[model samples]
Target: MAKQKIRKGDLVQVIAGKDKGLQGKVIQSLPRDGKVIVEGVNRVKKHTKVGQTARGSQTGGIITTEAPIQVSNVMLVVEHEGKKVVTRVGFRREEQERTLPDGSKKTVTRSVRFAKKTGEAI
Candidate 1:
């Protein structure tokens, strides 16, 4: 399994491939395949034959929809200083001392995703 940083509903920009430079919100994330489906990106046309659905008889023709793009090919977008910018994501872990019910102190580490360029939490 691949570690997934980009997730569904995240605004991302295509960093490579045929759709390079296009930005869109993530519609789905396939962590198992390290791929994500972004809205309005990677559009592909599919020809379909006549078919019937539970709703009723469906009209089928050339349908355009989004296709999956590799997770590594997209970068998350964030607002920085009034401008939308793309940045690499970095994880920051901080340990805090917490007092248990028995009065014993324990350290707990929390993980956060931040933009590497601006150091802003996302």
Candidate 2:
């Protein structure tokens, strides 16, 4: 599987579907499904039967909640200049030196995500 560019808590803008152009923070990321649930976007109504719970409390009715949308339909939002703008995400590997218990130094590479538009680490 490929690495997911969008993660939970990222600000993103919808570029397709009925919620196009809407910006919201990502509430959840489903990398396996290639979908993300954004706050205040792709809302869906769910109906349930009214029934009693173990505590005898009523628990069932119409509920409105966010629905997952395709990851490709959204673009990551980042601060560029002095304004917020949507941009593509890119990955870069950074190397760092680490000291071992044997008094030896080793170099390790880690993947980092960045905002392509501003070339800034995210």
Candidate 3:
């Protein structure tokens, strides 16, 4: 599996495709397929036949919903200065000292993500 940089509920902008320049929040991420479903992006319409079932009556017609787009097509949106900006993401390892139960301090390394532009945590 690949590392997922774009997570759910993240605001992103479409960099390619017909929805270029459109911005929306990520609703779902499909890391296995390298795709993500963003709010109001890559919408597809489906037509269904009406049927009666035990659960409920189905009267489906033309329904539109978001579809998955390649992860590379979207970029994370971050607030910079007073406006939103798009930048590449990078990870860093930070070392921290922790006190164990034995009263001995041990150094631990943790992974952190930040924007490559301003070095701000995502």
Best by TM-score: 2
TM-score per candidate: 0.83, 0.88, 0.85
Question: Candidate 1, TM-score vs. the true structure?
Answer: 0.83
CA lDDT of each prediction against the hidden true structure = 0.92, 0.95, 0.91
* Residues 1-122 of candidate 1: C-alpha lDDT, one tens digit per residue: 64698978899999999999999999999998899999999999999998888989787899999999999999999999999999988899978899999999999998888999899888
| Global local distance difference test of model 2 | 0.95
Put down candidate 2 lDDT per residue, 1-122, tens digits, no spaces.
88899999999999999999999999999999999999999999999899999998999899999999999999999987899978999999998899999999999998889999899999
Cα lDDT tens digits for candidate 3, 1-122: 76988989999999999999999999999999999999999999988787777888667678898989999999998999998999878889988899999999999998988888888988
Between prediction 1 and prediction 3, the one with superior lDDT is: 1
Question: Model 1, clash count?
Answer: 0
Sort every candidate by lDDT, greatest first.
2, 1, 3
Q: Candidate 1: deviation at residue 83, Å?
A: 0.7
Clashing pairs in 1: none
Better of 1 and 2 by lDDT: 2
